[model samples]
Target: MSKTVGAEGWTVVHQARQKHYDDRYYGQFLGTRKDGRWIVGRMWSGRSMDDGFHDGGWDWSKRFAEPSSTDAADAALKSYVEMSHETFVWNRVFEQRVGEAIDAYWAGPEVPGAPRLSAGWCRTPDGLPGGSTVGLPFHEAKYRLLQYLRSTESTARADLSPRTFNLHDAVELIRQANGPFRFQHGYNAYWLADDAS
Candidate 1:
């Protein structure tokens, strides 16, 4: 009866939250067929065990929320596409895109040929870019964002692993941080963008 949201009626929802993602990625997406109906209760799409998966008992469950309006349904669908887009990517490299293209960005010595992040990338008053043509990796974006947040808001920095994400995730973070992903090192230090963004 519905063709809007990412998951439709009688669907399953799965969320696995852990201290780290380096483990076997064991998780489960349970569905129920009871009371003369198959109710989709849980869903997952990641590396798991041959037998199945678990969320340390706390990494699972289900819920149902009916949108009151068509606009609300469309918004929910947009959120679904943003979250599950990885399942439809064309390649591993494509999976890691931050903005534009990964190659349009670089983390090494440039030869005046690549299209790096520049003034045009950031427009928000809080996201002013530096006067350079350097781009950054996801982790570096994390590092720099932390610095900016702590500096501007007196917020305590969390102990986050910088290399725990792909380029696209990092770019999103940098943009959220109001634009502070510019490289402060010399041109020879382009390689540091990933570890330092």
Candidate 2:
């Protein structure tokens, strides 16, 4: 059986446990009643928080919009209707609004009683896909280890053949070296050992 709990204009539901899941991961699906429709418009409230997050005054009381589920639903309905009336339901209006909301959320004024998050990131050693590099990087020791491996293992020898090694072997090498490295575990790994099948 399932129950729908309301708050600050939102309907909160206990999401079903995923098959084969192992963690104590719990989440809620927030929905809005628009006209006669139950719209799961808002994103999932993350897979780790509590259902009581709604009742807890320390959550988003200060920063977030209206605090009543019914009111929140009404507001969402207005936003939905407005967004739907302009262009399509999925249009630049909603996109721009979402972007603005995200920007504002990040540039927070720091709610007086809200929980605080403290974190920082360094830069990646080789840069990211788009050629722009930045953000919380691995420990400097990891970079030094990578450099050492590259300098020593990047060479090709007549006796050294990719046909002799496999992705598992490479992973084992990393494990032996006590790595913070994770195998990419994709098509790239399939081609690592030349004849890996």
Poorest 10 consecutive residues of model 1 by lDDT? 183-192
The global C-alpha lDDT for each of the candidates, from Candidate 1 onward, is 0.29, 0.30
Q: Give the TM-score of candidate 1.
A: 0.19
Q: How well is each residue in 86-159 modelled by candidate 1, as lDDT tens digits?
A: 32322343222221121122121232432233221222334444222335443343333433322222121122
Q: lDDT per residue, candidate 2, 101-193, as tens digits?
A: 322222223334332221111112332221111221222222232222222333322133445333234423432332233233221211111
- Model 1 residue runs over 4 Å out of place are 1-10, 13-69, 85-197
Worst 10 residues of 2 by lDDT: 187-196
Residue 30 error, candidate 1, Å? 13
TM-score of each: 0.19, 0.19
